[model samples]
Target: MNEMGKTDTVVQPQSSLLELKKMFFLYLPVCIGGYIVFRVLIVLPLWFSSSTEQLSVLRIIFIILGVGALAVVVLGAVRAPRWVEKPIHVHYRHWAPAFFATLVILGSIGGHLVASAKINSNLALEKVKAHFEKETAEYKMGRNAQ
Candidate 1:
């Protein structure tokens, strides 16, 4: 109590970097666990029961995990200030993990695009090869008839 009969309190300043590290340590594991559970419980069984390739399932899972991590990091960045009641500094160490994850997500997207293009180009080459073979066969047959 003070002379005026009112209680006083002192608030300590909080570190935003520490809070951000804690958020990453907390949320990343949860996202990884969800990814594993989804892959094992849902995708694995369906994959085994089906008779075709499951490459697309792996791609879908990667996409879901990437989006989930991106969302989590974005939410954390937005809400951290509200929790700390102060502006966050633009420090590389503070945001490195989120940046790395974002980079990985972008790399995976690029890889998928490259793979799709290669597959499409291969299909086109096969089509051209088939047409060439058909033309040569027709030429041979017409020459023999003449």
Candidate 2:
């Protein structure tokens, strides 16, 4: 105890924290690049493909990714304190929220686009069917008149 009758504490930053910070800085760029590559090479092409069945598969993929994002957020929340002390899991708690948000945003946008595309294609098909039916009916009436 000092003459002031108060406790004095000295705080020192842990080296593991520093290393985790370094790892996070390195991981940020890699994660962004990976996301971009996956989006361009896989997601965009699949989403925009002319094949109707491919959209179903793309929908499933986005659903799974969205679920995974939620899981990561929940897991991080439950394990954050312990994870912060562990070097291997330290940075995940910090990044999981961002990851979750990105997944959610992308999933919503993709879902909307897919739904619009399907609706437009169905409308076009219906229009074409109606035109064909009208033409067939007119031809039949002309044949009966003759």
Backbone clashes in candidate 1 total 0
Which structure among the candidates has the greatest TM-score? 2
Candidate 2 achieves a global lDDT of 0.63
How well does each candidate superpose onto the true structure, as a TM-score?
0.46, 0.52
TM-score of model 2 (CA atoms): 0.52
Clashing pairs for predicted structure model 1, backbone only: none
lDDT string for model 2 (71-100, tens) is 766766665565536565346646646564
Over the full model, what C-alpha lDDT does candidate 1 score relative to the true structure?
0.56
Query: How big is the positional error of residue 138 in model 2, measured in Å on the Cα after superposition?
Result: 2.2
Model 1 / residue 79 / CA error / Å: 4.2
